[model samples]
Target: MAEEKKEFWRWTESNWKSPDINWNDAKYMTVGIDVGSVSSQAVIMADGKVMAYGNMRTGSDSPNSARNALKFALEAIGDMPEDRMDYCIGTGYGRVNVPFADRSITEIACHARGANFIYGPQVRTVLDVGGQDIKAIQCDEKGKVTNFLMNDKCAAGTGRGMEVFSDLLGVPIQEVGDRSFEFKGEEPAAVSSTCVVYAKSEATGLLRKGWTKEEVLAAYCKAMAERIYSLVERVGVKAEFAVTGGMAKNRGVMDRVMPFVGLERMKTEWDTQIAGAAGAALFGFALCKKGKGRKK
Candidate 1:
């Protein structure tokens, strides 16, 4: 039999519910759905506290992705009925496609709000390196966005760009971070091209010139770091910097970018990928408190 091809770009999917929180006793039950380009997340909050969440790969149909994400979260709370949810807010690239949402908020605002909740009130700067774009946001203690800049025109420095490299190198997405640090000697110069297609060509040339896979990976990560740093610079870095989205988990990029940005990332126990959805849930909760709920 021919050797099976491994999917190097695939990432893990998961769902979780808080064991300590009893949704039945909560005064408000809110839901947030974030259907992004590469992934979809659904978060359930009870009285402003996260009760359950699900993260999964986005499928071809965005509406189905949103529903599937919500179904995954509901699995953790077996008895929770969808109709019992007081409010549901949608946010992300496919926000308008969330059929069940009462309102749609921009991912930029949601990310800032979610970062404030995850990293605490002190978080001032949020850098979200997502699949198709990079967002650098400045916010106040309450999670309200003060200023922000986003780079959506290109895949450079984004998760999708990294996935292309992962496939090109035949390296599993999860291993890219550790393997990137395995290169011998000094770090190689970053790949020169900001365009993914040109960068792939540049990498191919480097490999032909005797560069190891590890070295090439390191160089690509370095390039990603520099590109991300440039985006963050436009919004102005602040103390208590926080990173959200999938890229925050990759030490390859985070390790290289932190020193350049000159700040320690704020710590959070929650999954970084759920930030946008979590923020949406929190927004729903606030609206519920103000007598705003799902439209009849």
Candidate 2:
């Protein structure tokens, strides 16, 4: 029998709602949808506090992904009516395509704001590595964007980039970070290319040359760190740094990247991947409070 093809990078999809919230008592109910190239997220906030959220793998249809994400979020909270939401804001690559969003915001701004909310007022810099791109953002005390830069030119070092490696190694994506560190030998040198296709080829060559899977993973993780560091350096990093987006879960890349940045990362209890949607929901809440969204 042919070897079973393994999907190593498949992360969990989940929906959650805060038990403390009472929908009937929520003064302001807002929603945020983030539809990206590789994932989609929905966040529901009640009176500026997170009430519920859902995350899913994005499909080819942006609108469908947005709706599905929202459905998942509302499903956990008794499936509220859309008209009940005071405002809806959309972010990420497909922000403009959200059919129900009252407004759209840039991912850069949303990420900055979300990072501030998650890490508190101390966060001055954010590093977000997503499916199709990586972003380095600077923000003020109030979560306003001061400076930001993105690397969307290619997929290397992003979520999709790492996914390629995981699949190639027949390792689940969630395990990549830990497995990379399991190698007892000296860490291998970083991969040479920042292009996903080229890096994949390079990885193949290394495997052919007797490099163990763990060694390859370590090398790939180091390369991803180096790529992210270069982007952060160009944006002028500062103290109180925080990382958001799916890649934030990867300790292998983060451990290497932290040394290059020369600063301790600010900690947050919130799910890093939900930062963009959370920020968008906060923006919607602000808009609703200002009487700029749905009329009463």
Candidate 3:
């Protein structure tokens, strides 16, 4: 048999529930489903705080992805029935495809709101780098978006772009961050192209010329940082900034971009990938408070 190639770009999936929270005691239960191009997240909130959440890879069928994410989350609360949710909101690239959602909100708004919740009310700026796009958003104390800019036209500077390099370099996606700092001497200059196709070719040539894999990884990270910084510049950065999405977990890119932006990222105990879904859940909570919950 031919040797099986290891998949280096896959990230770990997870689900969790707050140990102290008992869903049966909650007066209101809400759910938010965020189905993106690369991943799907489901967040269940009891009253206004998170009770359980699930993070998983997005499937080809968006509705199925949404259902699976919810099921995964519900697994954390074994006896909770799906019908107990008072309201449901959907967000992200596949927001419209969430069949059970009472309403759909834009990821931009959801992210801003979620950032406020995760990073605290002090967060006024949020940079979300997802699978296929980047978003820079500025919001007020209440998490209302004031201004935002998104680069969805290309895959450069996003998770997908990093995945391509991970495969090309034969590095595990999780190890790319730590390994990038292993090269000797000063950091190398960034790769020339922001376009993934052209950049891949450039990396191949650099390897042929004897550039080490770590050096190439560092260069690509620098390139990714520069590209991301450029987009954040257009919308402007504010103090108490926070980063969300998959890229927030990648130190190779985050470390490179932070110095350029000149702001320390706000700390959050919650998973960054769940921001959009958490925000959606929060929105559902607000609607429920307004007596707008789904009618039986």
| Per-prediction TM-score to the true structure, in the order listed | 0.98, 0.97, 0.98
lDDT of 2 at 180: 93
For the record, the alpha-carbon RMSD of candidate 1 to the native fold, in angstroms, is 1.0
Task: List the candidates ranked by TM-score, beginning with the highest.
Answer: 3, 1, 2
Computed on alpha carbons, the lDDT of every model, listed in order, comes to 0.94, 0.90, 0.94
Candidate 3 residue lDDT tens string, 221-283: 999999999999999999988999999988999999999999998777889999999999999
Cα RMSD to the true fold for all candidates: 1.0, 1.1, 0.9
**Per-prediction backbone clash count:** 0, 4, 0
Candidate 1 per-residue lDDT over residues 98-182, each given as its tens digit: 9999999999999999999999999999999998999999999999999999889888999988888999999999899999999
Q: Residue 70, candidate 1: how far off, in angstroms?
A: 0.4
Clashing pairs in 2: 8-171, 8-172, 8-173, 9-173
The alpha-carbon lDDT assigned to residue 20 of candidate 2 equals 90
Over 79-133, each residue of candidate 2 has an lDDT whose tens digit, in order, gives: 5776788899999999999999988999999999889888898899999999999
